[model samples]
Target chain A: MSTTVTQDMSFLYLISSASVLVQLVMLILVLISFFSWWFIFRKLFVIRNEKRKTDDFEDIFWRGVDLNALHQRITSARYDSGSLERIFAAGFGEFNKHPAGSDLDAVMESTRRAMRATYQREMDYLESHLSFLATVGSVSPYIGLLGTVWGIMNSFRSLSSVTQATIAHVAPGIAEALIATAMGLFAAIPAVVAYNRYASSTDQLATRFESFMEELSNVLQRRAAG
Target chain B: MSVSALRNSSYSEPRILLAGALAVLVHLVFIAVLIFGLNWKDQQPEGMMVEIWTELPTPIQESVKTQSPPKQIKPAPEPVKPKPEPERPKPEPVKPEPAKPAPQQAAVTPPVKKPDITIQQKPDPIKEIKPDLERQKKQEQERLKELEKQKELEKKKELEKQKELEKQKELARQKELEKQKELQKQKELAAQQQREQAAKAQREAEAQRAAQQAAARNQITNEISKYKALIQAKIRSRIVMPPDLPGNPIAEFSITLLPGGDILEVRLSRSSGHAVFDNAVERAIHLSKPLPLPPDPALFNEFRNLNITVHYRE
Candidate 1:
């Protein structure tokens, strides 16, 4: 059994050594394909939950609820992935830290800083693995093309010894080469589509966070001044 | 915290990790299978066979006849001696009748008498005569030495003949070498002459090209000077100063005119601090219509869309 395993491994090693560039390209494609599927599934769930939480948070926020009560509710839950909730938490925490009747400028500056920090964290979460998705989308096709070029080179090398080259002789190699390309597209197309969709959603959420921070800061400023 | 909520959060990380690991494993297995298939398909024999011989044992390989007893065949016959003279004389009277049959009978008779007598005698004294046979062999050796001396002389003659053939080949080779050298010298001389001729031709061509370029440049310069004068004259005649213009301006004003001698646009390329003076110069250019055209077409081509620089002085 061990010898057979070793034999199989050495056989693979021979193929890899015969065309290292193709093997490397295929390896990279496989890795990208794996990671792409992982991210696609993971992000699908994450982004869906984020959308739901954000919508629920927004609804509650606009329903004439007391700001302090909303802060308590968000703090108690603790795992809120919503962008608006984080922004609100950051601003409210800073607001509570300062003494009552502090100057409006000092209060607003502290709130803005907190909100900015939280905004960065939210954006980081939203953009996680997005760059990997982007890399996969852009590089997979070229990687697949590299495999195709190497396979064609092998085919031509075979032709030097063969008197007659028919479709049967060439087709399997071409088919295997094209499998890499098909897998690459399979990995890339969804990644690209998902990236675009997620990026837009992230941007919209970011805008919402910014606007909420602005409104919250104004409200705090007015309270301090009054 | 709710049990359902806590369970969901806890399970998410493991679920994601498991899914990621499974995906990676699947892809790795797929790649491994692909590579294995490719290798199995492409495998080819690489080594060649070499033959080697082994010797059999010497004793066993020897002929079996060498170990067996010797066997003998019957002795060969000897030649018949001529009959004695007495017998020949007696047979002469009967010979005519027998002579015709004698030749035919001689043809049929086998000469086996010598070996027959040796086989019959078996003499011990004749066995002792073998010692004399050795002495007779020494005498034969002397005869062979004389023959060898004659053969040596013949070999010397043959060596001379080989030497003559070698000398002829050497002479032919020398002639061939001389012929090749002569041909090479002729080729070199012809090549040298051709190179000198080509150089001379190239020098003449270069000189002709330089002379043509000089003439062309001179013609162009003369044409440019004529056109410059013609353009200056046309401009001086056509340009008109406005009555309201200042006597002195700080800077020179350059105005561009279009084809047909109409002012298409004007700009203060150099701005005068006095805006009114600059404006007046611009107005003067606009008022000047259909400036005088150069009579020569070559001059006109140069002066078309002319840029005029006017300096105002107090």
Candidate 2:
């Protein structure tokens, strides 16, 4: 049969009005998605550089180079952006501030405080803007469902005017409404993936910072006692 | 004490005593000022009465006292003078009468004339007579002026009464005109309501006729469906079954029929699964052209566009 399909614009109007909240939520999701990608890429670059610098510094430090000479090289170059390098510099600077043969306990206390402060600063920077990604991952599906509910309500309301209902009468409206749900999933999947990945990377970096602090503290303690 | 001990001892005791005494003196002064000031403030009047007392001068106070005492003494002196004036007049009149009786009595009354001279020196009787006569003439003039004012007021009241009567007549005329306008407005409103009633009745009759037409149209639709079913069955028999049908395929096809029962459009809602079998169903619909027509024009119009579902494959 030649199926006569008619759409009431009033249905669209109802759907659009109900979808305002969904649209607002989707807008926020999209913004969060964009910012998450941005942070992921930026942190990827920063962490990669930090890893390289840390590896180089560890190599140089264990090679029996004089620490004062290494300090001069680090000061002049200023190229190292690693957390370990900053921790090392803070601890050593505090160690050099005291007179020679001062109390070993006092020297170690100052160096530990300096390294803890630097570690806190680096962790804060790495963890910034991560919460928004988490919120997007958790809430996006519900936001998309809100849009789908609004669209289905409009479809059912228009069915009242129809004398004999058929698939042709309902399909297009349902299809258009489902697009929002699909978009929500689209925005949410990447956010969730990025959050899990970045969180693990940040945890690894934090563990490294803590272990480095302990090792550097032991080194400064020995230097003070000697 | 040694020299250092002597110096320290000399400085310390006097300094401590002087500081202690100064502190005590300061506390005593503070306590005295607080107690006495509070007592004096409580004795003072509610607001500032000092302003009112400062406004009066000594000369005004003195004038009030002097004026009150003089007024009290002047009334007493005037009564004494009246007594002397009456004695003097009695002696003068009594001398004439006694000359006929006793000349010696008339000579004794001459001493009463000296008393009259004492009264005249006081000048109180002459001042009292002048004031009394002046007061009586002033009261008579005041009474005459009051009578003239009463006559003028009566004339003004007559003019006011005439104006009030004119205003009352004008107000009555205005009230008559307002009543006439209100009556006219009521008449117009009643006419408008009658016109509206007539129009509303006409609209009701028109709507009833349209509803009757719609009912007739529905009856015609029922009759056309009855006849179209017979024609559809007749056309179904002429359709040949295709031999290459797949495995007992069963489906239905619907077609829109025109006014003369000619198939307009055809589609299969349920597919027979075999492409050749489905194509045969479509060709059958095309081959059966203008199979039958309805007898009545209204019934024919009702079947102008029709939907039919046909079951294929037995």
Candidate 3:
């Protein structure tokens, strides 16, 4: 029994002994899982970085740093600046483009538009591959199920030639087939958890960006009115 | 946003490479853990006792011993053997043949009487010894009579012994004949029983084979019907029926399908009498490319050439 388990139930044996179509399905699922994880890790880094930068910028802005000096410092290091910083710069730059003598309402409107566009772009970046993660999370299990069903069907079909089938005859095929579902769940669970986490965090970041936009627009509004 | 911040929004190539490398490393670690972790633990096996046999057990020995009734029948025939005892008297006539030699003994006795007469004539010459000779002749006659009587008694005893021996021989011959008949009857009975058993087994085998064939045929038909329903459903779903004044017209098609369930040839074997409906059915049959089939390849032969009749109602 020990020998049988070692020989037949090995991971490489199960994957290699699978039918060609089932092997293809497993390969596709593995590649999908790999890419999803890659995206997951990438999103993890990007979102964490964005959140840290947002925290830093919020601290500086609320500390009442001189708006012009902050803007100049951000423009100088624009290449390394975060998403919230970019939104702030866009708003500040647009505010500066219109003279203080211009109609206050028009200047405020243009600044808000500029900030909103920049905020949208940053949100787009944050939310880029969450959909891919979602697609992988939802569809990979079905893909695994497809492989399983096909594998079981093939196994049973082969049994047509056999007059008397025992459990030993069919067990290996089923075990190999079930490996696909196991892999599917393996791939899907992490993707789903990561997707949920990243999606909500991205939503929170968007909310923060929106609130910052609103808050910055009001500050600009007060200055323009004065 | 400024273009430089847009550039920051995009991931650098180095970061993508690092993420990809990390993903590969993580997956490798995960697979390695799966392989090694499962193998590290040893499972305890349940104990089971097994008996090993060098040869198959033969339960037939007792049955074989029981089937042979001839041993018991041998004892039964022993009592019947005594019934042939009345035939024991048949050897009694042979006892008289040994007494035919008594006539030759009588001829020899007449010659002894002539010698006795000569001895009497010589007795007159010797008057002094006449009385003694007469006494001696009388004693000799008596002794001869006793010897003759003893010979007759011995001959009778010998004839009785020969008769008894022949009677026993006759009984043994009768017993032997009866035993031969019994043995032949036993052989015939065993042959008949063996023939009966063989015929019965053959009949049973034929019945079982017929039943299995019937069951296999039923299963095949069931599978074929199931696949037929599937193909019909596919075609029905694909049918873009031409609207007209037709009631429920049935169209029959003789379809030839490849092993993979792809349509090879679709000929309208029996038209619905409406060319439009027939054409529509044919078009639907073709439209449903590679129709659903049973996964079993052995059942595909039954589905290779199908004559399906479609009613244009539902």
Candidate 4:
């Protein structure tokens, strides 16, 4: 009977046996995953509300209500106005600032400038922390890979101390190292998928906002000529 | 930038942290379920074993004249599995052994008697031919004398010839008795030698058998300890010790094992006094089911009921 004194190796054992560098890598990956998931869920609500707000504001905008009356009503409930409604407000507000019988081209240009500014600000808000999701999606896998490589390296380094090496000697090391990669992918995959979905939906909203800006600019231009 | 940062609703730390805690809770629950589920599967005991018994030793003599010696030590094929019964009548090798001496007495007797018959026949042909020649000569002489002399002379000669014939019969009887005595001595010598050889062979066979029995016993102990160590190794790996226990607590168990290494029962013969500590050790053994066992059924008797003491600290 060979007296091979094997210590109990479980998931806990794997973590306990990990080298310092690899352990740090695992800790970092865990935090990254945790934070990424937080942003992912938070962004889910933000994007959904943006879409609903855009849709609701567009329905009223297309009802052909008087511009002055629509602007006044929305200005009173300005906090509730979506990107589309805000854009409309900015354009009409700038148009009212122009004196009656002013140069029509200059008036339309001023209105266009105000509408463009609101569109940029709204797009910035829509796109904020989206980069954070993208960063998490693309970087977490690499962080996990870094942990795996370090763990395996430490595992190999342990082999140098072992005079007689068997698979059991290094199996725990490799398994522990691979867990880092698994966690990384767990954090990255959903982030990547959500980022793709949200980015596309935001682009759809952006396209609609741009088209509304053009339509509103054309209406104001005609009103100026009349 | 500070005023704007305060203005950004999306970057609120409290809201993000609450979201993170919820997300982490979901993921942690999912992982815990998977890991614990996998653990239950691993804990199942599916180990297997088959008992083996080597051939009993042969003392190196075959009594049967026709068969070769190769078959002498071939082990008997294993009988049906005697399941459920934990005990069997042990076939202790020390019992009465079938005699194994080859019969040499029948081959030795004939040559001892043949010489006596050959010696008696050598003088018989010569004695018969000489008498016949002598009688022919005497008969010719008597014929001539009968013409020349009276009948009384011939009668006297006849009595003398009869007496000489009686003497010759007495001599042959004495010779036959001598030859019989010589054959008897030779038979006795052959029998004595046969007895000596048989005694020597018996002594050798007995010595060889004693040596074989000793060897078999040694092999059995070595095998038992080897398996004991193997089982301990497997069980030790499965053990999950309770943390922060005081002293080096030791627990002892009396385990009943089947021939195939399946643990029939494990009784806590002595507890470590710490219930959780004792429980962990028991669970370890349960997980290490179908413990490693000796392959020989003969050896299984040693392990059939065994006492194992597992030390918690060590």
For residue B132, give model 2's deviation from the true position in Å: 99
For residue B192, model 3's alpha carbon misses the true position, in angstroms, by 59
Model 2 DockQ, alpha carbons vs. true complex: 0.02
Q: Model 1 — TM-score against the truth?
A: 0.41
**Which lDDT tens digits does candidate 3 get at residues B1-314?**
46445546444422666778888887898788766653443221111111112112223433443454454455445544443343333333333443444444554654575467547644643553465676665565565567556656655665566567656765765675567557655755665566557655765676678679989899889988888899999999888888873688999999999999899999989989988888888999999979888888998888889898988886
Best by DockQ: 3
Top model number, lDDT? 3
Candidate 3 residue-wise lDDT, A1-226, digit = tens: 3236334456677678889989998999889989988998888888888889899999999999999999999888855688889899989999999966888888989999988888887888889999999999999999999999988988787777676876555666777787788778878988999999999999999999999999999998887776
Residue-level lDDT tens digits of model 2 in A1-226: 1121122223233235444655565456455545555555555555566667677877888787888877666554444335666667767777788898778888788778877876776677667667767777777777777777776776667776786886655654564466457656765776788778878888987887788788877776776676
Q: State in Å the error of residue A44, model 3.
A: 0.7
Off by over 4 Å in 4: A1-7, B1-18, B37-314
DockQ score for candidate 4: 0.12
Give me the displacement of residue A112 in model 3, in angstroms: 0.5
Q: Fnat of candidate 1, please?
A: 0.20
Sorted on TM-score, best first, the list reads: 3, 4, 1, 2
User: Where does candidate 1 stray beyond 4 Å?
Assistant: A1-21, B1-314
Give model 3's docking category.
incorrect
Candidate with better lDDT, 2 vs 4: 4
**Number of the candidate with higher lDDT, 3 or 4:** 3
Ranked by lDDT, the better of candidates 2 and 3 is 3
Q: What is the TM-score of each candidate against the true structure?
A: 0.41, 0.40, 0.49, 0.48
Q: How displaced is residue B210 in candidate 1, in Å?
A: 88
What CAPRI-style quality would you assign to candidate 4? incorrect
